[model samples]
Target: SIEIGENEESAMCIGVAILDDLSYPIAAISLSAPEQRQSDELIESAGIALMAAGRKISEQMATG
Candidate 1:
């Protein structure tokens, strides 16, 4: 999500669910950046990266 002025702070946040073996959400991973430092393209890229990282964490958790 993108926040123009949430809590009086300009920031961008993105997250992805980390799922268990049964495909239940066990946790989440997120990234936040100052709005001024992030462009639309950067946010999109970050979202993709977060999703990949979340999947990796979920996989590790399931296997262990």
Candidate 2:
């Protein structure tokens, strides 16, 4: 994620492990933001959103 934004002054990234159908960690989910465009509150919001997404993906995999 070093240059994912390419032209940003500063960026933040947060990720969570993604679990397989068997509940094993098989991948990951990452959320990124450009510091100049995001406030600390926004970054926190994105972190929560990222976690929620990971949980939803796990739930879907478990159901399917």
Tell me the alpha-carbon RMSD of every candidate.
Answer: 1.8, 4.0
lDDT of 1 by residue, 2-63 (tens): 44556447766786889999999989887877888888788888888888898999999999
| Global fold similarity of model 2 (TM-score) | 0.69
**lDDT tens digits, residue span 1-64, model 2:** 2233455447666787778777898788887666677776877787788888988988888788
Q: CA lDDT of each candidate?
A: 0.81, 0.73
Span of ten consecutive residues with least summed lDDT in model 1: 1-10
Query: RMSD of candidate 2 to the true fold?
Result: 4.0
Checking candidate 1 for backbone clashes, the offending pairs are none
Model 2, residue 31: what's the lDDT?
Answer: 73
Name the best candidate (by lDDT): 1
| Superposition error at 24 for model 1 (Å) | 0.8
TM-score, candidate number 1 = 0.82
